[model samples]
Target: MSTILTYHYVGDAPADAGSHKSLFVPKHEFESQLRAIKKMGLETVSPEEFHAGLLAKDLKRKVWLTFDDGRLDNYELAFPLLKEAGLKATFFIIADHSLGCEPGYITVPMMKEMLAAGMSIGSHTLTHPHLARIPAEQLAREVAASKQQLEDALGVAVTSFCYPYGNFNAAVQEEVRAAGYLLATATIRDNRNCDADRWQLRRAMVTPGKSRSRFRYMFSSLYHWLHEWKNRKRWKPREEA
Candidate 1:
């Protein structure tokens, strides 16, 4: 089982300190975490690797470092830090909001530059809306349209999807799978997919507030066990059927 490390803003670009979704990691702290990722020997893997691993039952040990919303801070802050570390990551972009070829969350030049610099781009959705309860047509639009948007913008095949807010059900997953996505990541869900449930891969939320010891613990399975036991909050059960 691979632990996918999920992150948000890195540079705190919106510049507001109190935003919860942002979770702005300052440049220095972000660099520290990047160093930690490198020092820990967690080889970064793309979603394509996860998909191929599911098919071949290969477990060579890798971490999928992913960022959601395609935020400006990701391009400004995270990109440089990862570059310095000689690493790369996947960004899931909400497509409809992209104006002038890039959304306010991220700019056009940033996307162009990142692709030019060898980064993988994925689709979040066309509008970043709640998918589980939306109409079928709308859901299809969100799935297919956003992918088309990404491929057109980046000039590469966009095959991964990350659920917005981690909200997705069986039908939603089916929609995304049929829409040509190879892998889909869900928030707050964790497990190694054994071919049957590869679409909804789980991720671990690594926050700036977590201590270095806790960070180290995350590289092991014990981290999830201890976190769940300590909190007593039932995990959204792994897809075992």
Candidate 2:
């Protein structure tokens, strides 16, 4: 089965870190994780590659790397490391937070640079709001408008959509499909199998500073199946931003 890993921040922690500190993955640890991914012989593919391969059933132990929030550190830190390792990743950007609107989010120029460097870009929505609890009209606007905004800004078709905070439902999934996204990702609520659902792709989160054994376990069938069983009866779409 192919596995996709999701990440958030990729940089050193600030001296005066706040609640978001746990989201920050140190530069050294991030590099180590990449090396481990390589050592496992899992090729890092883009969303398009995964989609095509999924349809063709031609992938073997393939993996896709993804970053959420479009943090500037992804450009300043993860970009160089990924480039150096000859690997690629997809970044999910919040449309309204592009450029100067957000303090730490990646800017327009950085996104263009990432695209130029062969990385994939996707929509995380216009304002990163929770979709499961929003009004139908607002949900439609967030799913559709974010894709349009990113395509207009980057001049590329944004084919992937990740639910903000991994929040979504049947209606939200349909909206994402209606928005024209070929693939999407949700954290902790999905499996490694690509045949599950196109619009509600499952991804495992990769936190920094974990042992090699832990990382290996994350990609194992046991972990995936166990997580599935654990969440099956209690399954509910996330509702937080």
Candidate 3:
């Protein structure tokens, strides 16, 4: 099995972040977490490499680092730290928010720089909508059009995708596949095995305010089991009721 870690903003939360402040991890904390991952002797891989490893069944002790939303803070803060650590990650971009269309998101030039530095890019949809709730035609556009836009902008074969808000259904998965993505990531909190579904691959979220020890535990073998156990406990009462 391999571990995939998901992150959002890499700096302190801004005032406009509102209730989603937890998505913003402090810069120092993110740096420390990278160091911890290194200390644990885990090798980080790009999305393409991770997919290759999965196909070869050689994913033991491997980690795939992923960031979503393509926020500007990721380019300003996380990119340098990752470059310093000699680590490469995949950033999922919202096509509509990029290319200077939005103020706080990453632009085409920033994404090009990251790609030039060995980082990978993936499509996060056109506008980051809830795929499970949208109409089929809109879903196709979100999935397929985003891929074309990113590839046209970056000149790279965009093969990876991430579900917006981690919301996807069977239809969404099919749309992603039909759009030509090799793999898609979801917010499912668990480690993934080689046999895991490519369209719904699980990821462990790295959020803010976690202690050093707790952060380190995220890379341990026991984390997934504990996470799932707690989730089952949280939902068991509802199932019974």
Candidate 4:
């Protein structure tokens, strides 16, 4: 069994919470979470490692640590903590927003340092736009441009993604696939996937809450059912209207 842990801001931000809304995970809390993972004995692997060997059907449970958006805080807050724990994470950055955002943004130099220090980088599209709502060509442009920018800056293969706003349809998934992404994390909760969902992977949303529900969820599939029901309902009402 495997679990993907999703995160956003690793450090404090303006309370406004723009860009990635619930993606924010405070620094101290993140450390606490990582410590918990270690203390609990779950082997945390990179997405690539899971692909390689961690996902064997009989393999013990594992986790993947993922961060979204290219915030300066990732470099400032998350990096040191990850280093102290000797753990690595995959950071899905909005390549175009790598710099020149508000008070601060991640620069190529910062990205370079992380890469050198063993962190993996993935794309979150060019402008962080909703790929599902845009025109066909615009969607293609966003995917291609982000992949290119990250490749040029990081000088490594940028292969994974997490859909912006946690909203993507089949067309959007295929577009990202055609653009060369090997894996993508959706905002869906509770369901752990098999090999068929390798490209469109499942990541449990790690909010300020839900960290301690492990034993509860383990005992009850109904807990997972209720969570999925609510999240799916979160999207269905607009269509009915």
**Top lDDT: which candidate number?**
3
lDDT of 1 at 23: 65
TM-score of each: 0.86, 0.92, 0.92, 0.83
lDDT (10s digit) by residue, model 1, range 83-142: 778887888888876534454487656777877776778889988888887998999999
Against the reference, the lDDT scores of all candidates come to: 0.75, 0.84, 0.87, 0.72
Per-residue accuracy of model 3 over 120-200 as CA lDDT, tens digit each = 999999999998888999999999999999999999999899998878877888889898998999887777555456887
The TM-score-based order of candidates, best leading, equals: 3, 2, 1, 4
Local accuracy of candidate 4 as per-residue lDDT tens digits, 1-241? 4567777777655668776555667777788877877777777666567665434553245667788887778889988898788788888888767844444567888878887877888888887887778999988888877888789767888878878877687788888889887777777665455666665676666665445555325324574577667768764563233
Q: Worst 10-residue stretch by lDDT in candidate 2?
A: 232-241
- Among residues 3 or more apart in sequence or in different chains, the pairs in candidate 3 whose N, CA or C atoms overlap within 3 Å are none
Off by over 4 Å in 3: 230-241
- Candidates 2 and 3 compared: the better one by lDDT is 3
